[model samples]
Target: MKFGGLQLLLAIALALAAGVLGAIAAGELRDTGQSQTLHHFVHEELDLTDRQKAQLNQLENNFAAERKDMEISLRAANSQLAAAMEDEHEYGPKVVSAIDEVHDRMGDLQKATVRHVFDMRALLDPQQQLRFDRQVASSLTSEPGE
Candidate 1:
């Protein structure tokens, strides 16, 4: 329950790093070209059959719908926390707790997203799965404007 100074510092540093990474990833996901990139990777790189592509699209749409409300709530909570943080007395702990709750919600969302993607991957052939993995790696490496 207790942490040394070094341990606490390291934990804070890692959390900050994760926050930065998540922000960057969220920005990338918001990109309009990302939709085209996903379609191209699925069609050409993974060589998903027409039916498979359709199924995948349907699955993604369902995920988007399912997560939409939760995402909005999380965003709103985050904004509230940020606003509250400007005040020291009335909202400090409340803002910190709200931020922590939002972080937990985001972590849950990430886990669900990974599970769904893995389920989709399971439907693909081995060669296609390899290609898909490579495509993801390539996408991660090739940042915006590069």
Candidate 2:
């Protein structure tokens, strides 16, 4: 099937934008305190009490260390995949292994993130829990770079 020039150009532009956004997000996540940001949002947006805020902060701090370790593993896995790609030997097996490692690390990170959110919500009252649920739903629908 033949493709139109504009369609192909549009596809390429979209792919480029996705790559740029991914890189920017990775840098921000690596250098910034995302765990702190999560607590800040819950404190400011959920009208949490001082004690609840402290509890949330403590929870986030605990999760932050684990999350950071998972991120390191993910980065190392990605580096291994890149090395495998650039190696003189056949890349198929090495690349597959690295990708699987990345997936496992990512799964751990995602589990921690969800657990963090749940633990934070548990500290809130019923009203706050409802509001927090709505907040999470809206946040999920937010645009990139939010």
Candidate 3:
């Protein structure tokens, strides 16, 4: 039997969810020393002194830790909302309010991430800062057309 539009959308969502779980299971999404983006950016882009590298690395670690905690809390909130929705009688104003709260926290987490990036930028010397800005601009401009 041919699937209707809603059924097709549901199937697509299921597939996407399965793909995400599979990636996590395969260790592709695991945190690793080599997978730290800020560290990689500094190593590849900046000519930092040993002391500078150490300080930057510490900052990167702190940012990653805080971001991870925020992500975990967000996931917990989403799961709570989903569980609430599954209860037909209980899915009311409370569920809607919970979802809104989670959305607000997600927005705050994103803004915090941006602020952390700026903190990283502040760690650079004037010459390195100029180079960093140029590198970021070039990377964005090099992206394929929309």
lDDT per model, in order? Answer: 0.63, 0.64, 0.61
Worst 10-residue lDDT window, candidate 2: 27-36
What does the lDDT come to for candidate 1? 0.63
> Please, what are the lDDT tens digits per residue for candidate 1 over residues 22-139?
4543432445545446446676767678888788888888878866765665566555554444333233586578667767767766766666667677768898888778776776
Per-candidate RMSD, Å: 8.8, 8.5, 7.5
Q: Distance (Å) between predicted and true CA of 34, model 3?
A: 16
Better of 2 and 3 by TM-score: 2
- If ranked by lDDT, best first, what sequence of candidates would result? 2, 1, 3
- State the lDDT of candidate 2 residue by residue for 40-86, as single tens digits: 56877777788987887788789878777777776666666555544
Tell me the spans in candidate 3 whose CA falls farther than 4 Å from its real position. 1-39, 88-92, 137-146
- List candidate 2 segments past 4 Å from native: 1-38, 88-91
User: What is the TM-score of each predicted model, taking all chains together?
Assistant: 0.64, 0.69, 0.62
